[model samples]
Target: MATESFLREIGGKSVVEQIVDNVTNAIINGELKPGDKIPTENELCTSMGVGRNSVREAIKILEAYGVLTIKRAEGTFVKQGFDSKMLYPVLYGIILQKDSANQIIELRKVIDVGILQLAIDKLELESLHKAEQAMQKLEQKLAAPAVDINAIFEADTAFHMVLVAITQNALLEGICSYVDQITKKSRLKAIEKFINDKATERFLLMHRDMLRVVKEKDRAKINEVVEKHYQYWEQVTC
Candidate 1:
């Protein structure tokens, strides 16, 4: 296939950025398949009518996003894990830095509630087992004379993420990941407050009961528990 057929002359955008977009489009369009070597610098220059520096820098940008990987003897190959999502860290970081605890708690409630309803259809014992493992880890963390809030948060996040995983929705998982990332600091602060207030035991018990209701396929009860959990979380966090 001809490289010129895909790449175009750089317009208003910076030459490197344009090349990056073009190559990214190529990947999305499957013109550049996974493990396929990217066109050499000379070919990219000839195809896009850009300079060698532009092509090299463009390849570097793609590589930073996990889109392309350079080999010593070979060449740059399109990486398989090249989702646009790999670029979301900066955006999520910026948004999360500006977001408030209240806003995060509100978003958490909405996203969790929606996912819980959807999860009921495909709920299985194994899924419940995963949740139970995570919950037990949380309990163990809290039981320590000196609780590690971060460990508690990790366990809590795992339990919640496992619930969503049962639905097997990639987009949903990605969105939840962003929410989880954004809420990390807030969750830590809230957990610290909740622990000092001696509310950790009730929280852990609620989650254990949550596992029970989910295993029982009790959607109505689980929904109520989820709503109450978020509310209690907000009271502590906000």
Candidate 2:
């Protein structure tokens, strides 16, 4: 390949951006494949005729975005795919700033209800069994005289997570995990305030409704039940 001179005469911008763009375009154009080693820092310095520091800095920035992955003994390589770890810290930052809980919960209501509708179309026997198991566990936990806060939270998280898991979408599951982390404190607070025998029983009944609709493959029923159930949390969080 005839390498373009990324450091040529231009306005006084640094070569780092050109280097990053050239490399990124190469990866996007399939010139680079997953596990393909990036040019060594020394090699990039020589090829781009720039300082080693410039190349090193660009690589570091790209690696942070999930465009590249570095293995300790092995050299850097194009990433297999974008990973959620890239966005989780950013999501957590947004949550910590405490500006967007309602926005996030609203987004959750939209996405989660959509996932349940999809699960209705694609529900497998195994997924229903998993949901049932989660539900039964919730029942057992709720039967205790003094419910464990963490246990109830985990069961509730698992119950909703299963909805995304059964949809068989890795990205959706990753997103669910991210959102769960963002709202963990607020959700726990809501649970502390709103959870009781009545609330737990209502949730169990909602889960049963979801399972029944999924088992029957009724899209309308599944959508209705899921939206109603999830709206309960949105109201609480709001």
Residue-level lDDT of model 2, residues 16-134, one tens digit each, is 88777777778777777777777777767777778888888888878877778888888888889657765765666666766487778767777867787778777888888898898
Instruction: Give RMSD (Å) of candidate 1 vs. truth.
Output: 3.7
List clashing residue pairs in candidate 1: none
Model 1 bad stretches (over 4 Å): 82-90, 93-97, 100-122, 164-182, 209-213, 218-227, 232-238
Candidate 2 C-alpha RMSD relative to the actual structure: 3.7
lDDT top scorer: 1
Q: TM-score of predicted model 2?
A: 0.77
* lDDT (C-alpha) at residue 56 in model 1: 90
- Model 1 poorest 10 in a row by lDDT: 82-91
lDDT of 1 by residue, 1-238 (tens): 3453567778989888899999988888988888888878888998778888888998888887778889988988888653546647544564666545676666667777677777777787788678778877878888988778898888888887888887877756877777788668767777887788888877887777666666776777765777777656686664
| CA lDDT scores, all candidates in order | 0.76, 0.74
Clashing pairs in 2: none
Q: What are the C-alpha RMSDs, in order, of all predicted structures?
A: 3.7, 3.7
